[model samples]
Target: MMTVNEVSRLTGVSIRALHYYDQIGLLPATGHTDSGYRLYDDTALEHLQQILLFRELEFSLKDIQRILSNSAFDREKALKQQIELLKLKRQHIEDLIALAEKTQTTGGTIMDFTAFDTQKIKDYAAQAKQQWGATPEYKEFEQKTALKTEKEVSAMGGQLMEIIAAFGKMQSMDPAAPAVQAQVKKLQDFISEHYYTCSKTILGQLGQLYTAGGAFTQNINAAGGPGTAEFASKAIEVYCRTAK
Candidate 1:
């Protein structure tokens, strides 16, 4: 485990920014020591690596969180896309360097500004973001959310958490019990009605995401108390299997 200061030095990110990232739920520390110092495990470091790469690509923090939180997110695929985008950025820099060298040789005679065009890099980065971030459900979510006032959206999110919190009350029951399954169904229907179509497949994926131990899990557990997310996931798994 590495301390926050250690991470700040290693990543060249300021301690203030690291705290801000933690505050926003963008990159939570793995744990805290008895003395209240933040500690990060290898998994947290890996997550930080992804965040830094997205930052290098000039992705907004909100966009980065949305992309990483996506249940459909594939780490390997995103890494590959980031690699391509970085290569393009490197090529763009090299082109600019060559242009500068040529202009220097010609004593500033070259008036061509084509080498400064970054449209290609911008286009590729935009395409990559769309590929990884704009899943079908996300698109649908965007459409639905675009019509709502901020207050309305916030209310909807609270309502959804209320539903998940209800699961905490039944944590002691068998996850496959009819009551638990019914609750899972209710949660699924709530998502379908408000956000996007929550088909069994999608619901199953969401179940996994809820317990995958990040912001979703954190928020869910916060609403329902500890282990609530895991219980809900198991109940969802059973519901999906029985529906199948």
Candidate 2:
């Protein structure tokens, strides 16, 4: 058996973290010395390694606990999942780096944008340009956004938050009301004028996306206040039902 300090030295995991893991029942030691020191066997080290891998992949402690404790937990399967997620994340970072290099000022260092969806955002930006660049709305939208400097984009994002805040104000009302529907229309128009032509189907998906969590959900909830995402989602569902 190895002491907590031994594991820390060997794996570079802090003793504090290991203790927390034990506190959370994540990586309890196999035994304890009579003098009250924690002792971990070789099998416990393997479990710790798996926990570290999940942490590197950004899995929450609660999720990691459930997964590792499950009877179906398979080390090989987990490693494969880790590999795929890492590759996808690396690709996103790489593409952002390449794009930043092209548009950046001379010698400007690439800023960390982990909270931003570099790939997904770029994909949405290109969607209309690829699908309907010939349409006047797309052309007009492209022209407008094309002139936006980085500061303008930031400002535009702030304006978008105001729209979301407006939606939050209507949360107590029935989602099928004319007022709610009008706000939904405004939201659709906002995307069509700024980004892409947001049809009812796409609008519905965007509502779900807002509630899906991450920085997007965080920003929406922060801007519009709590329950805003769910409110918008319910409103979008009602709007889509009416459209059909």
Candidate 3:
């Protein structure tokens, strides 16, 4: 048996965190000392090992607690999972190390993104353009946006939220109504300003994505409840057909 402090010193975990774990019933005390201090036995040591392993793998404490509470939780099975995950992490780290070494050999500093293969850069740009669109003035746009900080993103998000709210207000209006069309134009302008130039193909694809893509629909639904994406799709499609 060992005191909580002894366990903390031996395990390198903070004493407060161990107390928290005990308070949450994750690593319950095996018995109390005469002085009312907590004591842990070998069983608790095994559980602590599992907890530490899960924490190292980035599992939330709650998730670790739930995993360990299950009667079917098997130590060997969990260890096997940990081994597989650690192997993958090791491979990822090795790849990063190779990339770093290559960069050093090529006289490329950390921020020298041009050191990356042009093909990889082109592929990423193509994917982004497909998802959004192109602005011929994008170089200028990038220059303007390069200095934007976290605070600016939060402020920009607020403006977008307002635009989206106005969009929601127009949902019950007739799709063919002049007001709805006007709102759709505003939506197009919104995307153009924040993203890039709007293309017909991208617009059509965005409409389809609202209904067909899980990620798109999930984001829309999560924002202001469900059906927002479907409504936006209809409004955009109607706008596309009628716009000059």
Question: Candidate 3's residue-wise lDDT over 195-239, tens digit each?
Answer: 456565566566666566433344344343456667777877877
TM-score of 2: 0.44
Q: Pick the candidate with the highest lDDT.
A: 1
Clash pairs (backbone) in predicted model 2: none
Per-model TM-score, in order, reads: 0.73, 0.44, 0.45
Ranking by TM-score: 1, 3, 2
Name the runs in model 1 displaced over 4 angstroms: 144-201, 211-229, 238-244
What TM-score does candidate 3 get on C-alpha atoms?
0.45
Better of 1 and 2 by lDDT: 1
Looking at candidate 2, the ten consecutive residues that score lowest on lDDT are: 124-133
lDDT of 2 by residue, 104-128 (tens): 7566655666634656434533331
In model 3, residue pairs whose N, Cα or C atoms come closer than 3 Å (at least 3 residues apart or on different chains), thus clashing, are: none
Candidate 3 has an lDDT of: 0.61
Query: Clashes per prediction?
Result: 0, 0, 0
Q: List RMSD in Å for every model shown.
A: 4.5, 16.8, 16.9
